[model samples]
Target chain A: MLNPGSLTVIGLGPGSPAQRTPEVEAALAEATDLVGYAPYVARVPHRPGLYRHASDNRVELDRARHALQLAEAGARVAVVSGGDAGVFAMASAVFEALEAGDPAWRALDIRVLPGISAMFAAAARIGAPLGHDFCAISLSDNLKPWEVIQHRLLAAALGGFVMALYNPLSRARPWQLGAAFTLLRQHLPGTVPVIFATAVTRPDERITVTTLAEADPALADMRTLVMVGTAATRLLPRPGGAAPWVYSPRSVPAS
Target chain B: MLNPGSLTVIGLGPGSPAQRTPEVEAALAEATDLVGYAPYVARVPHRPGLYRHASDNRVELDRARHALQLAEAGARVAVVSGGDAGVFAMASAVFEALEAGDPAWRALDIRVLPGISAMFAAAARIGAPLGHDFCAISLSDNLKPWEVIQHRLLAAALGGFVMALYNPLSRARPWQLGAAFTLLRQHLPGTVPVIFATAVTRPDERITVTTLAEADPALADMRTLVMVGTAATRLLPRPGGAAPWVYSPRSVPAS
Candidate 1:
């Protein structure tokens, strides 16, 4: 049912139009107000009845509140995020806004539409390094302490988890990813595969597969997703010497 | 370009047709052979040229080899998997086969299509409990040792990761999920939210949101995906006493 005043949180799916689900497309078509980060909002096509409410990054909560306000005022709203909105995106912020906002807002209809996350999209472009048990950690220390990130990295490395690291490096936090690599090197074998996927699914996409020993911090930027494979991961040699296929096997022999 | 003898690994996206991406849909339309677990293969629409090759569960390697051989014989093959194929699904098995099989298989065109994984779909059904740092661990001990699963469970719990546990409980591994709960209970608060989502996005879908103290192992089965929220997760009170929203906040206060 199309509620007159409702908020639908939808993912844009890593900058590719083909990756967007039909449900998300329907939500966008129905939306009177589109609210999201500026880059993500710019991805949507301009329509006559739709109002684009684009804001800068790091203002997720403010964006969530704006969507809620629009919905409360009887506007059909779609809150957008690149990749899956639930994964380190605007869905959580929307819920946080609903939690702290007027109690009447709780009665408003809200839906979250899932999409292909950046980690999965990147993993797919370069075979599947996340084809086994994995963990996703955001290296940006904007919220959590650096100590927590360090501890989790050590835990993931020691546990033999294939890891997808989001926001690996930014101008402000240049040293965190290097420190994380150092911690992994201490526990994981140097032969383990590490994939650096930058701007995945976009025209400027770059996917590189390297070993843990050869992994450089500079290979990753804010737009990159770094996938570190477990010891069991394999690098298949391509015929004619193309980029090798990187993937983790499904089975692990009994310990 | 659509290669005549190509292999495309596609995700069915948690059982909903609307959840399937157009890229995957196009791959299905172009495939001459469809291979996967019985239930997932059964989801594909019937077509005159498509040959459905459905096999029982746990025969992933055999299925992969079959698909490869068919593709090698100049058939456009689509390997289908429920949810995202990369996440503990056929994508890994296919890669393993390619690495161990004839080197000629390496020259074949291969692609993996990402979809909405069970964890993401389950998270959206309620609210985004995975809106922060998270780990996905497969609970079935069919491959890895039980001890490894236990250690990772504890690591994820202690590390304050919102966790999505796949293959939580099967008939053969009925006790594994319970053991995981016991391990988590030691490190996490009893008030943390635990969501058991069974057959997500399917007609018979069941979603239960409970507290760590009250979560019952019997409530989950092989088809269930269990999500445990972090200490930072919130449960919003619904207006008129409906189901409360469950979500983890995007930011964490410094420890």
Candidate 2:
């Protein structure tokens, strides 16, 4: 009889060590093999019993399959990601691989451990831009067409949802953020607040708040998490004359 | 001259002690006053120097004002929420109060400490239903209107986004979940997966995965976090005939 091995997908939270949850830490501590993107896997401390498998970005399916195979071979495997594994991370890739791979692979013990998503960390750094109804969409067109992203952005804006845009820019597609801002300006007022949160929770984190008209798409890179506020979102003045805080009110007056 | 007092809004995460972040714990240890709903405030441990002010539900504005006043009076104040403070919690209420109250109130040193949101915790428990583009809406009509909620449900479904619905039902509003399901059925396929995750991260936690056609509105209560999947969401089979895991694939084939 083979000893039971398991697969756990864990989020490393954001950039800081404090962001990692105790549960995730425990899972990492017990892992026989750890697999993920290079930067994320590097965050895991080197332990005597752990075998680290670091791969380049965009090789998610290969990474997922390798982790699954290790688990199937009686190894406690942990696949890691920068933020929450479920949000634009390795969890979906693992599931995709498991669905397409061996049917017997499905019976392996697999679990996804949630971490503080980048959007939430960014929102907290500011006040609460996503306090009301909100939608999160990846602006990267690698998986879907640009048309679908445009349609969903329009619908989200029309629906009065505060939006969190992940993967706003990439090396290959630098113009996508500009297109997004141009489309949003047509329906939204120029004064609507937009937040460009870069490298959140890290020592070098930066958060800039601007209006839709004043926003320059060039400011956003792959590392930035952009938040577009709704008509009801308000910016509260900060004490001591610092930057104003942004938040969406919980209650909306019935029109 | 008095030193400026600070205010920190902390999310207790979901249920377990391990879920609370170290930053939140440090803030709690330093706070002179802890304020929130009775239940959330109760979660804070009794400390020698801490003053606990627990209020009833539905008095968010009052609670927020009280916290601000305490901060202004040179007391370190922490307003606690069950999940992430930015998501449908005290963060919004505090901003609302600051906007409507005296202009001087805006100058208080305030920060929101992020936590693991209930929806993320629930999603992590059963794989990743929110793996792709997704929206989160609170079903309670007390803040907005039923029409707005209904419109959002249709828009999210039509836009092909996974939806995480908060406050699905309460003792007073028993019919809202059923109404929401009925509206979603018009646009979504009957085979779409719906997850009812109750008391997540707690001992009484229960997870049920059902198709939209087979789902029962009665299963959801105030403590439950409901996730409705898009067409791209898949349920992976489990070994030994356990419940299949649910997740949304990251890639979408361009139509």
Distance from true position, residue A117, model 1, in Å? 0.3
| lDDT per residue (tens digit) for residues A1-255 in model 1 | 433699999988998988989899999999999999998999999999999999988888888999999998899999999999998899999999998887767879899999999999998887888987899999988878888899889888877789999989898889988998898999999999999999888999988899999999899888899999989989887776667889987678885
What fraction of the reference interface contacts is present in each model, in order? 0.82, 0.78
Q: Give the per-residue lDDT of model 2 (tens digit) for B74-177.
A: 99999999989999899999988888897777667888999999988999888888989999999999899899998888889988889999999999889999
Which regions of candidate 1 deviate over 4 angstroms?
A1-3, B1-3, B240-242
Off by over 4 Å in 2: B2-4
TM-score of chain A of each: 0.96, 0.97
Residue B151 in model 2: lDDT: 84
Instruction: Give the best candidate by DockQ.
Output: 1
Question: What DockQ, on C-alphas, does every prediction get?
Answer: 0.81, 0.80
Q: What lDDT does candidate 1 reach at residue A207?
A: 87
Clashes of each: 0, 2
DockQ of structure 1: 0.81
